[model samples]
Target chain A: MHYTVKTAGDQSIIIYFGEQISKQTSQTVQKLSNIIESSGIIGVEEVILGYTTILIHYAPTRISFHTLINTIKAIIMDVDLAKTDERNTIEIPVLYGEELGPDLANVARLNNLSEQEVIKLHTEPDYTVYFLGFSPGFPFLGGLDERIATPRLENPRKKVQAGSVGIANHQTGIYPVTSPGGWQIIGHTPIPLFNPSDDNPFLLSPGDIITFKPITKIEYDEIINSQI
Target chain B: MIHIFNVIKPGLLTTVQDLGRKGYQKYGLSVSGAVDYYAHRIANILVGNQDNAATLEVTMIGPTLKVLETRKIAITGADLTPYVNNSPVPLWRSFTVSEGDILSFQGYRSGCRAYIAVAGGLDVEETLGSKSTDLISEIGGHHGRRLIKGDTITANAVHTNKICLSRRLSTELIPTYTKHVRVRIILGPQDDAFTAKGIETFLSSEYTVTKDSNRMGCRLEGPTIEHKNGADILSEGMFMGAIQVPQNGQPILFLSGRPSVGGYTKIGGVITVDLPKVAQLKPNDRVSIEKVTLDEAHELLYKQENIFKLLQASIGEGGGL
Candidate 1:
């Protein structure tokens, strides 16, 4: 689960492992990232955690490349990444069907189930936040039942509005910001996952758990109007 | 006092930009900033400003700005036939712009973008340590979007050192956007995955920058470089200059605000030194690729650092405006 720091440039160092994305790899990345951030290394500006790698950006004028490599290596060697635990569960109220969940019928048909069954299955269990990426605050949540596994749309829509709930591959996530996405849109959340104007911009972070609670469209409207 | 410009005519894609908001890439936010950093830096330096100071990033067609106060200003990159109060203003040099002076620029005579920087720099709140606009995130810069007509921008009068117009740029540094460019590239970590012919095709191909090119990526049209292992490689971290070959085999030269990572397999990455050439490329502009060793890439980067060091030594400490 450990690797050497690869040289990205005069200002960046990337720690790489296997090139695949998985929960175990992501947890290791999240653990390492937390250690680096809390350790308070000088000249280190930011640590960008990915599926299987971490990009550490530093101010070259303050810390030389050699010093940075040594500092990262020293920190990595002593840190025991296995002991990290305790996941926090976060409840998300999702308004499914009709105007909000436009694809609810499509998803139910794809899974060969009734619309009510689809909602029951979706809201049944908690999902782990494997990683956080894709348009600020968008979390790649794992632990979706294989029965509901769906592929992305063949031709992605030009634009998917923010707060749209989606499922692609074995994962489900809400689009934090309005951008083009290929995931199968199942529902929408009234909660703002990312708000730059707010003190806390992102709603979800890595290692946090999430569970959907079906809500009425009237409730969705209420939450949206009052969020500002 | 730095003269504020009331934009009378807004161009296609005029926005406030700086070096960009770094360290936000982890959240999948693109490092949105000036599409042409070299020109932006030059304009800042000419105006006695910091490298990351906010300035107007003007696209092909430039805007007509009315000076609201007296200030020092300079424009670089594209030749737009700029004028101040109906009198022609020289490019790549600073000039004192008086209050009520009407400053304007026309369509591009050469290059695709231009940088207009003021003495003290644009006064804007820094989000995540930068004034650069991220239109997608809608976070930084002037309300995080393109500049519009009738919009007045505040300027910070922070210039301590002034640059004399007599300090003209030498021929070596004066950018010539007219010349056909050969962008140097470093081989990728997955370079061996591609066949030798595939690699050769990428390096030798003379590609034309498609009109659809933007700050995101420059879609090159010419040779379709087919990959040996196909485009099924895992989505990995991407840099500013990474040349990714899509399913169709056309190489997309990613630029400033490309996604942090995607599923495409990158064949090679353009050297940082040659990025200025890539930045200046306009639609239909031809560009050739040349492969270089990692050492060569490091050497070019070192050379740039040395030049900055030399400038700092000559200008003295804390010389920025």
Candidate 2:
């Protein structure tokens, strides 16, 4: 449960759990983040949780850096790491191959498997959401089956469409918005991953479990049209 | 009550901004806000609006707007040589704009950005509790994008008698933007990952802001900072003013519209009080970093806050005459 606190800027401090990424370390990071966030620490504006760290942004006018550090340290000493919180398991419907997944054939060839087999392996295991980053509501997912793991495209596409499910090396994720990326695309989802107009903007959050459910292109079109 | 203005011409990049959206970075949401926060606050204060009231943030160029109704307004930050009805108006002061008066800006003058605050804040719908525009996500401010020609933006009706007229900030309080700027910083969440010589190079070298620089970050080209091992690190939460160095060793100073986290190594972070100076810098402007202690940075912020409070009190006593 040992951790180091470092100053991020005049108003923020980063609490580092460990140097490497591991589930145990991530759990510890999340546990401490929950305590600090729910503790009602005065002047704490936001508590952002990373894979192996947590950044706390505070208002200096209400609490000084020295006081904030001491308060956080005291909270850390009293936190119970064994406690686990209940989380949701979200199912994301995706359409694999064809125009939606432009890189699926390439990924299958690189992994020495058929496109169908690649989709099977990708959807088999439930992946853990490491954190949300790179783009809005984009989840950095872990637990990609090593059998279908492949490298990213050498030259990234100039613009990747929103809802693209992509894989790069051992990691896999979804592009929540239209952005430039280098991941190997295997499928596309019709469900809006992010909508700022909605009450809850993000579809998934850190600590949630995700499983990809293969759907037909007709179903994807139906979902898209129904939303309109 | 409706208060609107017709956009004659949209300058380079004009968008509505406030203090910024908070409590959403955990979901990977960016805290997009005013680039020059000091100037934003001062402009709002001069017009007798709340400090966090949304104001139009004008970039290198300024927009041309025709007042649809008579309203009190104030212009602050980089002097873009604003003109109202073909007559020059002063900077950092509050004045009334009559209906049908056309307000426009000349070419580049001194600074890189300016702020225009109405007596009542702009009445844009808030997204995630903020009116500031997140350019990348296209989700806040007016239609979640920059203002364009022919767009009309509405402002809340002013119902109070506290509207200020011809209220100007003192000459000493005004900031002068120069080609060469020195900003203070507090070294590292990753300073230990750099070689001592690399830190020295960063503190001593005069870096030129590249043309590609934007509200997200200030890209610098100068001496490369030597790393002890490599530049890549596990992606982690980032803050405003973070100086991140990538594989090329060039530093990119993250600003108001930066992403929530990054993988590059951060050598240091600039003091919050000095961010306005960085915001005023234009492309090709030379910048050097000066190291300071964390306590000193905190003290400087406190001092600035105190000055603002005193100024507000004085204005109340003088009745903004």
Candidate 3:
């Protein structure tokens, strides 16, 4: 856990763990973010993880800048990097094709594979959640099969429904809330990654593992109806 | 006393806002709040509310409301020609309105937004420890959207407050809303991504705020800022005041509703002291970007934090208005 504290703005400071976006850098950033978040240190408002950095927003009046830097430095040393990595694997149930996934057929055609082959390749790997960004609770997942890689839509959709699982190039992800995107949607999941009303608003965190489980439309409807 | 006001007509875009939502940016949720934080603070101070209290943020146009029983209310930032029962009330000061008195705004005066602060904050449900409205996400504040006709606002009156009601801000402290502003910035966490010539072009060129600009960001049109490589980078954390230059060379100055992370290279970030000026800028406003140091930005911020405290002391003790 060695890092550098760089200038962000007047109200915040950034901790750069490494220069590149690697799993080691991500783990280090996540560890510090978690420590600062749980520290309950007055004046520290937020702790967000980037590829290899942590942007900490602190209130000047509550805690002075000089003191905040000192607090962070002390906390950074407390992060035991040698400890066993903590991982939480969440299974997201997805229903492939039909109205929910309009781009599924297009993706299969582009990849030169049948729709069944595309689904099989997609559901195989255990994707790693690098971070949550772009939109609320939208996970930036890594680890997609190269054979099923597809290009994004040239003209972005005006409205992509929530829970839509999309593939863009080598990246595959799920949209937690309804937002306009250009990803090549292949399927949709009924599980909500973001529920603002709940005490824990986001379902996934950095370093978490996720696997897509193929489910029928009836199962999706049952899960959706049960939640409601 | 619970003072309530019924909305007769909502303005172009009026919504309840406070300081902003914090701690949720990690989840990619926006930190929506008052754009002009300085003005928001002044209005709150005049009405004896906390700086973080929820106030109605009136945009380009203004709102019309029928006042019921209420405590002293203050209108600050962007004059907007606010009136009480056809009588024009001055901005930057607190005033009392009687029951059945109609409060409305006429004309687009100076500045782009205004804040209305009640003696006690508007009673709104808190989401993620904030009362601000996030229109994009549709969460928090008066159903998480702009105020519509027939909507009602209720504030729990704080009767035991000691601050005088007839207080007014001195002329020297009021921020001048200008069409052209030169904002100071601190060169960035990703400035290395840009070439030397690109950095030079950014500092020398004058930019105009485009129409596409909104609460999320101010999209500027200016000379192309050359980059050493491509414009895209590994997505990183972003905050308000971050000046991100996309492939087209133009910059986007992020505002209150900025995303938590972005993939573009950020050349610099506006200083804390100048963000209020950026917030008040209207579309097509011309701007000049200047560079400042980290130490200088911090110094200005520490000085600004004392403005409200100094204003509070200048007001007289409690009295019958």
| Model 3 Cα lDDT, one tens digit per residue, B95-117 | 78777999999898788889998
Per-residue lDDT tens digits of candidate 2, residues B136-254?
99989999999999999899888657554558888888999999999999998999989999999999999999999999999999999999999988889999999999878899999
DockQ of predicted model 3: 0.69
Pairs with steric clashes in candidate 2: none
Q: Please give the lDDT score at residue B170 for candidate 1.
A: 46
lDDT of each: 0.77, 0.89, 0.86
Comparing chain B with the reference, what is the TM-score for each candidate? 0.93, 0.97, 0.95
lDDT of 3 at B114: 94
Candidate 1, residue B278: how far the Cα is off, in Å: 1.3
Question: Residue B46, candidate 1: how far off, in angstroms?
Answer: 1.7
lDDT of 1 by residue, A1-228 (tens): 458556553345668767767778877888888788788888887777766777777766567677878887887788786787777889999988787667788788898999898888888878877666657777877778777778888899898989888888777889999989898888888888887766766678778889999998788888888966
Question: Candidate 1: which stretches are off by over 4 Å?
Answer: A1-13, A37-45, A58-71, B1-3, B159-167, B312-321
Q: Sort all candidates by TM-score, best to worst.
A: 2, 3, 1
The estimated TM-scores of all candidates read: 0.92, 0.98, 0.95
Q: Candidate 3: misplaced stretches above 4 Å?
A: A1-4, A61-67, A70-74, B1-3, B160-164, B312-316, B319-321
Measured against the native two-chain assembly using Cα atoms, what DockQ does each of the candidate structures obtain, in the order listed?
0.41, 0.79, 0.69
